[model samples]
Target: MAALCPNDFKPIGWLCRKKRYSLKWKLCISMIFVLMTSMWINPKLLMSMLTPVSEYKKQDITPVKNSKHLMVSAFKDHRINGSTRIISILNRGQLQPLFCIFCCGKNNYSTPATIDMHSDHFGFRYVTTDVLCRNKPKSNAMYVTLSLKPDVLYNLTDFLPIQNQIQEEEAFPYEFTICISSLFGSYNNVLQFVQTMEVYKLLGIQRVVIYNTSCGPDLEKVLHYYSEEGILEIVQWPIDQFLIPSRGWNFKEHGGDIHYYGQLTTLNECIYRNMYKSRYVLLNDIDEIIMPYQHANLHLLLEDLQQEHPNVGVFIIENHIFPKTQFDNSGQFNRTEWKKVPGINILEHVYREPDRKNVFNPTKILANPRQVVQTSVHSVLKNYGQTFRVPPDVCRIVHVRVPLQSNLTKEQLFVDKKLWEFEKPLLPNVDNVFKKTGFLN
Candidate 1:
């Protein structure tokens, strides 16, 4: 048995045990090879198990600040007719949703606008008005904010609706400019013009904007004189050259191209025309004046009012209609020299009709050009800052027009002495303007 099994050194049971141990080692090696292949295929799955959930989340959501280079080049507040438009530029071409957040009173709502594609990196984009109502919006003192990105937001500087209505192209350098709309060739009120302008000068007004359509020969002379003086900015408003403008503001009755010879357009244009040049704008007719009762000039009056109510941008001055029917009997200022001038002497019309019950006294405004957006003949249509009803005591509109209400007599009308306070300078100033313009000669 020893000679036959000389090649084999171990017994049968020992050989069988060695073979079984060898099989166990082979199984272990095969399992390790399968595991190595699985690990190579799904390495992230193993890492996920090892890493914490919060850390993974933090790494995933890393916000890119100021990544969206959205810009606003031009903006307009069309709230006068319940519309707002924003012109912007977007650098990135991705389809990112943008929102224009309007902050007004307690309401903060966002309206979506588009960023259109263009050839240039700085493309021109537009955002139209999202108005829900036919009438004016709930608040006038409003501002704009832009939001789209997760980390970046743009808060525009506090701009009033007035500033948004037009482009600041024709700006002037005057403290105050009176915007007299639609001077439709009427030179019938020379005396009224003289008085109104004189009072304006006393009130610290530096310039007057007249949208002239036509005028009397003599009136043209005065206008030319004022124009040469660099005090009057005359805009040759040839509305008839373009459209059949309305004869009056009543479009429903006397319909035309625009109401009252494009009066609305003229007023809006005047505001934009003098937006940068003038600090304050007084919107009224040539017959009207925002007269201060307690203070001497507009500067003092505004200083006091602004100090008290700092946030108010538009001051709605109440229009006190001093009917041309009533004349001062005391003979304070002689108007015999102005008889040939062909206009009413405002100095004589000291009697104002008493405000009747349920009757609204038409109002005018002395507004901050930067604060106002849209203006009507009587009042401000839209504004950026708060509007305030100026107290009658502080200042009010001296509207020397024909009586709107009937059955009001001398006794019924109240005599306001505010005009008399400026008589010292007003009298000489009127004469000087007349003489300087060659009306007195």
Candidate 2:
């Protein structure tokens, strides 16, 4: 028999073996397609039947109540409008916001933020509160494992496997400098303090400006030493050069909080207006230390914040006071051997609820300084958009403000018992915590 042609009407190749069987098979396939099409017409019913069913609906946390007028949970154990364990911060009138607080995590993305992933590789849409309530979608495992990585992994993975020429400029993330002005107090170490200054240098910190404002000469000496060592710029508002009354930098003594803060405001406005424009400015006293993990510096954090949300200013800090007690006029900072690294006792305090003990005086400075015009009681006076707070682990700017090394010394803090003896009763107990401290009694 002659071999059948490839497209013979008699059937060939795939249809060659058995005409009867092939016809039956085609008939069945066509019938199945028709059935599928009919089922698809009522797709939800089909999905209910054919999709793998989970017995239990995934539990999403209770959605945040009143997101627009964000209510940072009244400090833990402190009820809103009721309990008084921690002071309730009520937004009185159309007052300017101090810092935008968020509980974050799951509920954050539950209400899909209208995003444009392609336009800028990062964008946020103006979504009305009602829109958030209506179109929120449930997220699943695939969304996280396969999706979120595209932006971060693209640059981090470096794509060395395929081609090495990916332009770093197009990388979603970019580096920015975080200038920390670690001033020295009377209690300091010359060699060791310089070594501590080296941490910022190692993490690709391009510039470090130390406000060598010390009551004694130790910190100034260290700054001078580091200045020669090419790690820092030593500038001092010496005890002699103070802006306000005598010893203006002593914030904890003799109503220094007010004077020191005023001085900080003047200095910030001056420097921010003059010499340089930094992307992230941290307004911390010498006691504040901003430590980030895995060498993921400030630029990296800001890039992530910018990626997650478009615009933001200052990052409010949650201060953790150490030793879990009132002032310790003991245990001075003693450095015996020269060149020995100054040991910092990371006095881990009792862990309180995050929103509680992690006290945020919104005014704690960290920001694009030029963007802000002035500052009020823990509030930033800004010229533009709203400020948003991010997770602390992403940025832990620690404040070691109380019972400082100075408290351990013989030199009385400018608290001058003689001067305050008469006016003690008249001083304002502005904050409840301050009222309790009695320094303003």
TM-scores of the candidates in the order shown:
0.61, 0.40
lDDT of 1 by residue, 77-135 (tens): 34336344332323333446655555454454556654433222111121111212121
Report the lDDT of model 2 for residue 158.
Answer: 8
Off by over 4 Å in 1: 1-172
Model 2 lowest lDDT segment of ten:
155-164
Stretches of candidate 2 exceeding 4 Å from the true structure:
1-192, 213-215, 238-258, 270-277, 293-295, 324-363, 376-378, 400-441
Clashes of each: 8, 2
Question: Which tens-of-lDDT digit does each residue in 342-383 have in candidate 2?
Answer: 324222221211233354333254565535544432345433
